[model samples]
Target: LTCERYPVRRLPFSVVSEEDLASFERIVPGRVVTDPEELEASNVDWLRTMRGCSKVLLKPRTTEEVSCILRYCHGRNLAVNPQGGNTGLVGGSVPVFDEVILSTALMNQVISFHSVSGTLVCQAGCVLEELSRYVEERGFVVPLDLGAKGSCHIGGNLATNAGGLRLLRYGSLRGTVLGLEAVLADGTVLNCLTSLRKDNTGYDLKQLFIGSEGTLGVITAVSILCPPKPGAVNVAFLGCPGFAEVLQTFSACKGMLGEILSAFEFMDAECMRLVQHHLLLACPVQESPFYVLVETSGSRAEHDAEKLGGFLDQALGSGLVTDGTLATDQRKVKMLWALRERITEALSRDGHVYKYDVSLPLDRLYDLVTDLRARLRPPAKHVVGYGHLGDGNLHLNVTAEAFSAPLLGDLEPYVYEWTAGQRGSVSAEHGVGFRKRGALGYSKPPEALQLMQQLKTLLDPKGILNPYKTLPVQA
Candidate 1:
């Protein structure tokens, strides 16, 4: 396999032989998948842009099984790719080479839940939406949400330290994730899955795996803090004259709603047009240069509604907003959110997508997008900007009739250079997977990169766990 040439520094290495296959079957039995047809789905990413050359896919149901497999693979100096829902944007969830594919799909199980404390513990492969449903039934929320909720797994979210729509209110996973249980590359299970809110221990070791992108270990289970579901929810879709008004409206809403404000998302006219044209979703507001989707959740419906209404009225009267629509019913609220959440899906349907999840100063975000759009106007079919505005993260995507070298070249260093110039992050939410490894230099210092390499060397040593990912090649 091509992965074998990647130079994993360890011992007992060789191609998979009959003896290895027999040993693997002894552990997983029927779950050891070698059929090309079955392995086909596991080798490709969600975007169908990258493909791996793996010949075997192993689905382990328990942490013990995973540990056992890793022990054997580590002993034999074999590379392993840990996969969750395969919905990662940065090609982190899929294999980069022909390493063994270790999928957590069959490990889905809810271990425990504390109603009073609002904490839930579950296996790594449980779907995000399923976890949300389980907790929502008890008047609690998962404290995290994303467009890929239906397919993305909690372990995957933790692996990437996923920040989603509710981040403005609930904060990042770094705060909400209480503890984690991970299986290290050497088959050692680091069990720290506690539900305690505060623990000022020496190292906070579990954090190493949170955004490590499976390089350090495979996340087996997670214990996360859930928030109580608000009794009242209000959503408003507002049209703005330009990006400046979007920022102004955000500041105004933040002051007006305070704690009740949960989300402040922004989308440009180009994105709305794509969503309407591709997804067939009708735009709720008049066509404008920009749109802001503001949501507030609180225990008191009357108070929350009054706050939202007052803010909208003031913004409109002050010319901060041009037109708006308020969604009071649950169905209407969902419909409004769909327009923002479904932008990714709509863009996928358009053409070959080059996605960038970057962070820039809130004031310079509009200028960045405008500058990039002007630069790529001819080579790129469409360039759209939208994302969690309140968090300063922008999902800048460019679509082309087909993937071309010129189109990609024009977007790189230029976009990354611009972000770096503004002291912004090249990757705000998405981890540095195979796709963004080369761009790490733009965001990380040389010393930091050296330390990351040293850590990867110490953890895996053999470079078996998700090789060629997160950290770039050290000179």
Candidate 2:
């Protein structure tokens, strides 16, 4: 939440004048909120790691209103921060300074849903969990499911290119989002809201704004392809003696379960201990160095159970797994899945948490956590490792008495250097917000970085959109 230490200098942009406030009022009069109390929440991030001092917040209910606000802001050189759910981990959602907040809270509405093709088009501010429930009633499933589903807006998920629990099977938003409608910097509405699965007419322009993190434009609507809800689902929690056994178990599950494998997640004993101590959630299986949670969904319950049972038997028989528990009922399935999803909630109660969601080579995934635990045992409260093992994404977190400078100094260039040595990405699911913006060079080449800068310039010429985030500071 400290902004004084952050290195980025504020751009020389026009402040929101009385005239500017009046113009925003013209768009949505009652929704223009400038009260200090209400503005405090949107000014800070979900993790409470960053804060902004924006004086005005505008809530636009329709795409045309959003376009009008952006176009006017563009002409006046007034910086705007487009916000959806504001549940982002990195400092991407909150503003760094006094930029006018352009919120999509009032824009929540389901536009059209074709049950036959399983395509749903809705306003960008729709809450992800609400959409899931709405589609579930119609026998369709939203492709992306995350821990923040209850609060995270679908547009915010698309903005950050969120890769949640379902990515192992449903894939990324870049593939699931078929078309979108965005308001450019000049208020130009680029509507590519196509429902067709195959549209090769011209260049796919909507993909640019999908993961751009509100830098290029304000996404007002999204057209995503929703998959049908699977008839049968099962979850299994297993204990492994070591990381090697976890790997072997993963291989066996993939080879045997094949198509129905929904998610494959792993966590170390440290994570479980913290969850039990802080959150009072007991582990299903006995204590082990490692644990795995496997989920399978199919059309037939009996067939899925037989396949999962066979995989469990092979894993137990081959010594890949030491102990396990299975759940087929909905309530039990949710109870088991909560152990993996609630790691974030549990960490919040401990103390200030330093999180690094990185994508590393499978072999070197846990090495960073091990090295940190050995190096800084006294100063560091706990070094926990747990994440989506199926996609080689490691959620490495270090809890401490407070945010210590020495701990960060030892971890930073050290972790980035280690991941870079293995040709890994510094960020996996969490985008490079202000927290990790400087580390982009480690994962990107000079040529690629230049091209990204070029795109930013071409789209948002004035850089009035969410600044001091996404791309690294200009050299």
Candidate 3:
């Protein structure tokens, strides 16, 4: 039998009996879902590629309910997959077998907000954009923003340690996320939700669950530090002559714009073409070998505009950028961002996508893309490269007419080997889901991986939480 189809062996602990179901129904009336048809939507991932056969989907409204459900599941040896907005790129959000899914969808409540400290505390299932809207009205913005903001949950963001468009200016969740409350594998509630900026107390335990991908626990609540919304913003889309010019333009902009520069995103000609052709979005810049989207946010409109214009002037004067378009209005800014944010969606529409999110030295970023393109050769229709250039993270995506074993084989060791050679990370923003589990050794040493395994064994002796996911099997 397949690993997933293996029959469950009854344990000594209590199982979900008819009476237990009755108790669950009474506790959270009509919230627990058992219908197969209704559970189908949550059984799959955002990619529509990975599917799971979850028997039950629990929507717990309060942390107490979550605690109770997990306590029962722990004793019953029932594997649980904690789902957020279900927008994860990897199959981490969905179940691999017949595990029960515990979704935080009903726990979408804002607990508290401190305007003076710019700290916002909300339930784990809260949609990212909803929190952004709530804080934006209070003259503050969430430290992080991404294309999936409309669908991804704050809890998912914390789980993945997502680095998005705003990372260039506002920094990562590691710095912005103040505290987290997560339920352990054995139903122990870990409440470390402190809003304090500086805490020199013992081991920073919250960091463990930040990027654990729900293997260690289910995050119940999140306390994040928000940044004050910029009073004015300016966006400029520039088409560079080549990768070399793109780097030069970035340096020039960094020097000229300094702290005001919020984002420095890069895209190649093929990426822009895919976005234009697939999404029907008009390209803002003239044809070029490469394109860059530069953004500046500051307290004054005139200052932000001047900073962008000054940087552009220097870039054009130095031949770093060939053509450009600047946007001052909010409508135009959104239009420009759509070109960058929608590239992933456009690529998805093309064909089967093999996605790789890697972090290399900023200087060697273009080399990896160029090398991968040469290695893929003819069968791979297109190998496009783009991502948060400022953070030295590259989203190297390959699109093919069909998924082929040969294509995957050629890219696997070569890509990971190249990344490791440069003292870079194999998985940058995306966590080591099933797709990248085998490549964990490329980024992490044997000693570190051993420690990780030790911790995993200590936390989950039964291996019930997200089994066969993040960690790789021993040789």
TM-scores for every candidate against the unseen true structure: 0.97, 0.98, 0.95
What lDDT would candidate 1 get against the real structure?
0.90
The candidate with the higher TM-score, 1 or 3, is 1
**How much lDDT does each candidate structure score?**
0.90, 0.90, 0.86
| lDDT of model number 2 | 0.90
| Candidate 3 weakest ten by summed lDDT | 5-14
Residue-level lDDT tens digits of model 1 in 202-267? 899888999999999999999999999999999999999989889999999989999999999999
Better of 2 and 3 by lDDT: 2
How far out, in Å, is residue 39 in model 1?
1.8
Estimate the TM-score for candidate 1.
0.97
Per-prediction count of colliding residue pairs?
A: 0, 1, 0
TM-score of 3: 0.95
Model 1 error, position 290 (Å): 0.5
